[model samples]
Target: MKKIIFSSYLKLKSAPLAFMFALLFVAASCDTQDDVQPDSRALVSDNITAALKNNNWSAPGNSSAKERKPTFNTLLVALAKTGLTSTVAKEELTLFAPSDEAFAALGLYPNNIGNVPNLEQILLYHAVQGELYASDLSAGFVPTLNGAAVEVTLNGGVQVNGADVILADKRALNGVIHVIDEVLMPPTLNLVELALSFNPEFTILVAAVQKANLVNTLANDGPFTVFAPTNDAFVALLNELGFPNLDAVPDETLRDILLYHVVPGRIYSSDLSTGDVTAANEDTFYVNTSNLTITDANGREANLVPSLLNVQATNGVVHVIDRVILPELGN
Candidate 1:
């Protein structure tokens, strides 16, 4: 699996005022290993009743199963509420089960599960349609039966929405279970929800999207690859422009600025290069050191110091850039 590294972008000090056309250059850098791989182990195929009957699930330190403790009562209750107990008990599936302590930490209760807006959706998010072990998880958006997808970010630690997988590859009668540290929520409200859920630090990016009237566009479709700028990126731009804040800039300008950072297709970090790549607006810009540094037509340079790169969404990918990419005046 390709490990998605989340690092924040750095603040730049200059604004590009003139367009400078240059030939594209492909830098010969070290080939970044793409960690997108699926787990090789198949799902547990034994009969559910027999597996549960023979498995001594109560012993906390039992090496027969995984080291992690299973929330036997909580899991049963949640499955019953979602009407998935029978299916889960019969079929082969991989459940990324979060412990009861995780739910307690989130202040959620079993009785209140039905009251949550997307509780069923959230519960389904833990289950993979088919059987998969820890090796099956790759660095991409994996769809759930709930009509929503969750990102599998495998890096130094396996993470699902910044929550690490504490224990992996525990075999069950009907499926395999990977214990996660926190509850994973499904992405909603399109890209806005995705940004907020993936990293709360992108609040500024979300606000800018609302201000630009492009929230709906981003939410729509076409698998856009957004090079999102962090709050510090916007603040640094304002400082360079000698403005008190982003509000000082006209909405039209802000819209153009934000749009320039987005491309029409889903471009993963492994696919990026140092060259003049066309953006969604049909304007071309230069990327030096792969996406480490970006230069606009007007000789303005905005370094792509991302806090987190390769954030996958069902419809697109998000790379959090430190500074906003401004478009040409006439374009």
Candidate 2:
């Protein structure tokens, strides 16, 4: 089994040059706002120090660190537009505040945030119930207020759902703020809905779930990691068994086969290693992300399709497998 061990984070002393300009700008003009570079990575680098201020947000009328920190002007406006400034002020919550440059990337501005289809859900996806400091941030899924968990990876850097956390551990009166490079979107669809959305590709898998009467199980109750087999894999399995179609397979056997592909959790590719992984059916398989292969209990191996990995859903994550490896079943 691959043991998930979260190590202590080593804070980088030298930050990028952009946020450094904030300290100099503090001396130059504390009252003036500098021209923000509207680039993707620049989103995190620009005005990060300013974002680290201990603002309770109770006082939004003045230019104070304890009031409205200038770096997060875009975020502040978004909160105000959503009427969530008071919520951040009183409720002890964590805000994964995206930079102004991040908003600019999506063509969003202080005046046009209403253009977003679901602004509140998008905004709530960035905030969690309690303070999640840099130290407290571990490698896994952390549930957001929008009812979806954002995946966190601390390997190369701290990334929340692929957005880099450029600045972390900034104090706030009500909670804390972690400046991210990009905005986070909570998944609107569950696993079944997501699979259905990708119509042709997941058609057979969807059909199999329906056949097994596990549609509701896959749809509603999960945080599951599904290593799904393609239709070609199912066809090959049928040919190997001398069966004409899915209808020829026994219901209990099909259920066991479907359950063999699923694991109970939102496991990402980073969370995998070269070791045994227990499936929902109590059968075990060996996964090696190094070479992208999974060896089933029956000794048959299938390669994990890298191009189709980590397709996120509201209830879980899905990774495509080339072959449908089976458990040891008596003929």
Candidate 3:
């Protein structure tokens, strides 16, 4: 009887050991399965949010978008009007949102907002396609989805157009947002359109553009940096040539003159050098002169004093110069 009891005890102890071994095998299998699974990392959009939250966007006064009331309102309205509410809600977007005060200061949204044709364009000018934080913006031009490029001038802080990004990095669920004081406008003018805006002296230049049938081409996808001449500059050139206007000059002569001011690339004010640089027409031009002067085709030295420098458009940069350059005439 005692021997039977001992055998039963041994069997019970053996059963417990077997159950322990089975449990150990199951845990080992689970660990191996875990190893076979994919490793998960945060997405780029997620990274953007994490960075902003860490910077205390949710905190007070630390963020500009929070401090200012009108600017925030303008941004919200623009987002809705541009059909970007869903986009902003879904994906991360870094908005260089202008303040309502900025709009009021610029007289953009006067009493009548209904008559603005360029409202959509004005909104698009503020947005970039991807999520860019303050750290991501460098001293280069970034292309916007609006088919234009905004110059990212990261000096002390990021300046998009002439507006300083007062609030640097604010994060949203879809993208990042930077609060800018000024509303950025797209310079949709070609060489002629630009000339018409400021320089009445370029009336002859306008006629020449019409004559060459190159208005559409210049208006097209150019990042063409035009060293536009001012009215006084053209008047001075005309005075030197003893001509009242470009109508006195031949059509071909005027065409060559207009083409001389244009360079193929979008050269911003930051890119200019104080030496001889070549134009797209293969003629060498000098920026070494005091007022950024260039010699035209007529050998008539024209001062390239830009009435408006760094006029950024989607296709190119337009620098309104004071004098027309007649490169072909060699005058």
Could you give the C-alpha RMSD of every candidate to the true structure, in order shown? 21.0, 13.2, 11.4
Candidate that would win on lDDT: 2
lDDT of 2 by residue, 120-229 (tens): 87888888898788889888778787766788889777899999987666565567677787988888788889888878877888888999999999999988999989
Question: What are the per-residue Cα lDDT tens digits for candidate 3 across 29-79?
Answer: 766765554221222333332432333334224554654433345455555
- Deviation of model 1 at 306, angstroms: 3.5
Please give, for residues 29-62, the per-residue lDDT of candidate 1 as tens digits. 2112122222223434444333433443443444
Error of 2 at 66 (Å): 17
Which portions of model 1 miss their true places by more than 4 Å?
1-69, 83-93, 104-109, 129-131, 136-167, 170-175, 186-212, 219-224, 230-257, 264-278, 282-291, 297-299, 308-318, 327-331
TM-scores of the candidates in the order shown: 0.55, 0.67, 0.62
> Which ranges of candidate 2 are over 4 A from the true structure?
1-93, 104-115, 128-167
lDDT of each: 0.67, 0.77, 0.65
Q: Candidate 3 has what TM-score?
A: 0.62
